[model samples]
Target chain A: MRIAFTSVGTNWDAQIDPRFGRTAFLVLFNEETAQLEAVDNSGVQADAHGAGTAMAQRIYELHPDVLITGNGPGDTASKALKNLHMRIYVEAHNMSLKEAYEKYKKQELTAL
Target chain B: MTNSGIFKLAIASGKGGTGKTLLSTNLADYLARKQAVLLADLDVEEPNDALFFHAENKVITPQYKMIPDWQSDRCTLCGDCTRQCKFHAVIRLGEFITVFNELCHSCYACSDLCPEQALPMKPYRMGETRHQILNGLQLIESRLDVGQEQAVPLIHATQKYICELESKPAIQILDCPPGTSCPVVAAVDGADLVLLVTEPTPFGLNDLKLAVETMRQIDKAFAVVINRQGMGDDAVENWCKSENITVAARIPYDRQLAEQYAAAKLAWCDNTALEEALEELALFIQQKQVQYA
Candidate 1:
């Protein structure tokens, strides 16, 4: 399963960004292959409106099964993700991306 | 065709409550005696020019814009519309595609590029323009819907309405909205002349600088009209002098004018000085019209 984590930087050591839509980077962790990748989120940051929805679309395009972030997605994005059958989890505030992914693996984060 | 044979003067200000409406209404009132005048309150968000006039007859016309309406029966969620929309107004979630009208800029990129032809353009009422006849002056103002985000369409509609008038007025005074945003640009652009009304305070000066930059960028001919002259320092005047922009008129700070304005009364009714200043402004515009012509 592909899990996405909103991060402050491109690396696994980078802190988890609290904002889902305006985060600097979205780090994708492939559980089956044990490979991690980062996608820059500057395009979503520059959006005038519906940043959450735009971010959700970007994530949906990646075919992520789960989204792990410090904060929950906005109303519009939540509706879109729910329709896409994607589960979202909120945790890892002030923690690194790796730490957040470990907590997600342990089922310690709150589902939103 | 460029001239339109009618003098178009736009009153603009970067900051709100800098006496733009006051100057516009008074100038319209003064100019009506010499020529047929049309006062177009382009500040659709908060139109207040109509408040100053005792309108005898009023006609309201609804303004509409084309927005994308999706058709689910078309049997395809190709995501063509979703990918084409730069505004993020359209979103495809699994089997469903949702359209957010509020974020839509009406660019029609989605509907135009839709391969499935599921998206169709529909007219959405954004605002209403009121054509009012007051004593001798004609008032054309637009009122935006409470939650509507699109204002430029209404403003353009008002301008088109004026052009289609049976008898075009000699002078069309556009009372523009505050700030140097898209709405303000729509109001002031293509005008024969733009009068930037500003106060003489720090906030006023800062915003005036921005307004001036906007006007210059658009290559529009503009002049400054300073309100409450004595309230602030000589910085504004000095800056204008340095910039080589003319200070066309200066309305002094007066308690009676403020009181009358608060009561929704014309300040020039009891004040001859203000009335004379407005008259001079009218003459100045006339001279500019001739000079530009």
Candidate 2:
């Protein structure tokens, strides 16, 4: 299972960003590989329109099984992610990627 | 003045409520006495120019903009359409593609460039236009649907309708939307001259600079109008003078004018000062039009 976390930095200890669409970085953790890979989302942050949709497209292309963020995806982004049947977990704000991953493992986070 | 082309005068504002509609509708009515005038309310989002008019024979037409109609059956799952859409309106989701109509710019890049020919462009209702003739003036009001995100497409459609009208009036007045955005560009595009209405406040001056920059960038001939002359400082007039832009006319701040405007009455109808101001503006535009034509 691959878990995507909206993060401020590229590392596992990076604090999970509250914003899903405008997050600066996305940290992906693959259970099979036990590896953390970061995707830069800063470009979408400055998009004049549909920044969330662009980030959602990127997330969908990444094929993450689950997403963790402070808030849920917006309307357009929600529609894009619904196609992948990927569930999004929210209320991960103010936590590190590792803490969010641990909470996800224990089923403590809320599903968006 | 000899040219057969209509003199298009667009009344726009750097800031909202800087008297764009107050100026345009009155100007159109003022000009309509002598010759037929076309008044286009290009403020698609919140059009209120028709409110003050006693319109007759109002005709409403639905407006549409093209968006990608995805045919999933031709399924090769090729991501060409997804990759080409700059707006991110289209995204591939395994067996299906999601197209957000709100985000679509209707640029036709995604549909035409699709290799599988699955994404075909189709008309999607975005807004409506109302055409009414009253007091020898033809009023065309374009209004965007509540949820519609883009205003430029509807403005273009309204302009197209205006172009196809039977009568080629010698004078056309456009009441444009606020700000110097793409919609504003679409509203004022191809206009012979533009009257940028701005007040004397610092916010008005700041946005006036932006509007002036946009006008200069687009190379459109424009003049400044000072609305509510005494309400704020004379910064706008000073800035226009420094930039060598013509201050066409100044409509003084008056309680009566505001009362008439708020009551949905033509402010120029009862106020002699406003009437003179609008007439002065009309004459100024006629001279400017002559210089341009």
Best by TM-score: 2
Over B1-293, each residue of candidate 1 has an lDDT whose tens digit, in order, gives 13557889999998889999989988888778777899999999999998888886899999888888989998388888877887788987666778877778889898888887788999988989999986668999999999887788888888888888987787889999999999999988669899999999998999999999999999999999999889989889999999999999989888888888887777786888788778778778878988877
Instruction: Please tell me which predicted candidate would have the highest DockQ against the true structure.
Output: 2
Q: CAPRI verdict on model 2? A: medium
Cα lDDT listed for each candidate: 0.86, 0.87
Task: Give candidate 1's total backbone clashes.
Answer: 0
RMSD of each: 2.8, 1.9
Question: What TM-score, computed on C-alpha atoms, does each candidate reach?
Answer: 0.89, 0.95
Tens digit of per-residue lDDT, candidate 2, span B137-174? 99999999998889999999998998888886889899
Candidate 1 reaches a DockQ of 0.48
The candidate maximizing lDDT is 2
Question: What local lDDT does model 1 show for residue B191?
Answer: 92
Q: Which parts of model 2 are misplaced by more than 4 Å?
A: A43-47, A105-108, B1-3
